[model samples]
Target: MKTSFSSEFAKRYGLYALVTGASEGIGRCFAEELAKAGVNVVLVARREDLLHTLATHLEGTYGVLCPVIGADLASPEQVEDVFQITDQIDVGLIVCNAGFGTAGNFLDGDIDTELNMLSLNCVAVTRMVHHFGLKFKHKGRGGVVLLSSIVATQGVARSAHYAATKAYIQSLGEGLQQEWHGSGVDLLIVAPGPVETGFAKRSNIQLGKSESPDVIARQSLKALGRQKVIRPGVLAKVLSLALSTAPRWLRIKIMSSIMGSMTKQLPQ
Candidate 1:
């Protein structure tokens, strides 16, 4: 299904958008959606081959410019490299969708992997936001899409650190939304539930009911300037509503149980 955006979206955000993690999954979907809107895209990811293939498809199909930047955001040096290239481009929109998650006990997880996750999910996001946030504000028009998860709302046992990272994004996006309210820089935090993406395989977790990446991407773009936070897709909305009134302690336990189920199949 093709996602369509209003002319106002392109007008407000301008010609170019940069999507981190655009090699695959939700990031790829975001890239497709933006390209469908006739916005030129700069695709950023570690896999240069995948990025090139995707760039070809997007450019061929959507007839929009797709510049591929291959860099691991987990590395500080690589992030700097990305900045050097993007600095030359007038990117009016940035989708900070490059992040991974870990499953199983926090203590059981590898220290290196957890640290890497912290760097990519929290640190990299902050850097991008700080750099582009200022640029957008100065220009008085831009858009920022932060991909958070429903797990961000509370602590989950098997996915503690992963959830914590998303919490950081959730808090940051919410704060920036209010801080940049009148600055003509729109900030949207998309807290989606389980999505049908490569995350399940890489994270070594089994999803229950999940939403399509397209649904998440389409809905998020549509809500970019209209709202501060959005729980896109039916699964996300249902989960949010079901847990909204629960006590914090209850939310934690419930989420823990759900996470446990998803990760239970992992080798113990």
Candidate 2:
């Protein structure tokens, strides 16, 4: 991997980054990418074992400090604890990548789980962006990456709540991009399609054509300061464009059908 973008990115922003959901998948990729760029990382997630393991790996691989903070992002208190942990660190970048999905007819699934997803995906993201965003503005330099999904462009079946939460993220990130225009704080909304992660297993559904976590992470870093929104992978770009042009009703129907197929594969 080339150090040109990574090194330059950390230098322009701060040398320290805070990555939520940093134990696995895309979040892990983000932490690794930043560490490669000579940025120290503060990894936040719910699993202590995974967090400590990843922290150790990054520390040894990149020779950069990696602090592991185990916190369930859905809890308001835990979210605040994350901020407190980073309070003393000069965190220049924040990647809000901690979120999950529930797949089933919305009314049929466990409402409590959906609520938790909402809290983690939307509520937690808003708080982090608001708190850390201000710090970046006062300092006049920083970066924020909010992980959204192509499904956010329209409603999808089986995972309506999850999609809706990402929709909030999409709108929030877009608005913040303009709100912080002159604040020297760059915000990148990463709306990628399905990726090869444990999301399908957790959600109890199948997945479609997906990119690797590292692929999405790389595209995000490349688009960091240059673009406000990025749809990584050719397939993701295509899906985004198609959905944007299609009528809402038709788009929803198509997504519903896609969701139906994926859900059908799971054991009932």
Best by lDDT: 1
Q: What is the C-alpha lDDT profile of model 1 across 50-154, one tens digit per residue? A: 999999998899888999999999998998898899888889999999999999988888999999999999999999999898999999999999989999999
TM-score of every model versus the real structure: 0.96, 0.95
Q: Write the per-residue lDDT of candidate 2 for residues 1-268, one digit (tens) a residue.
A: 3367557866788778899999889999998988887788899998989989998888888788998899999999999998898899999999999888888888888889989999999999999998998899999999999999888878998779888999999999988888889888999999988889877788888887878999998899889989989999888888777788889989889888888888996434
lDDT of 1 at 185: 96
Native-to-model Cα distance after best TM-score fit, residue 118 in candidate 1, in Å: 0.4
Error of 1 at 237 (Å): 0.6
Top-TM-score structure, candidate number: 1
Residue-level lDDT for 206 in candidate 1: 94
What's the lDDT for all of these models? 0.91, 0.88
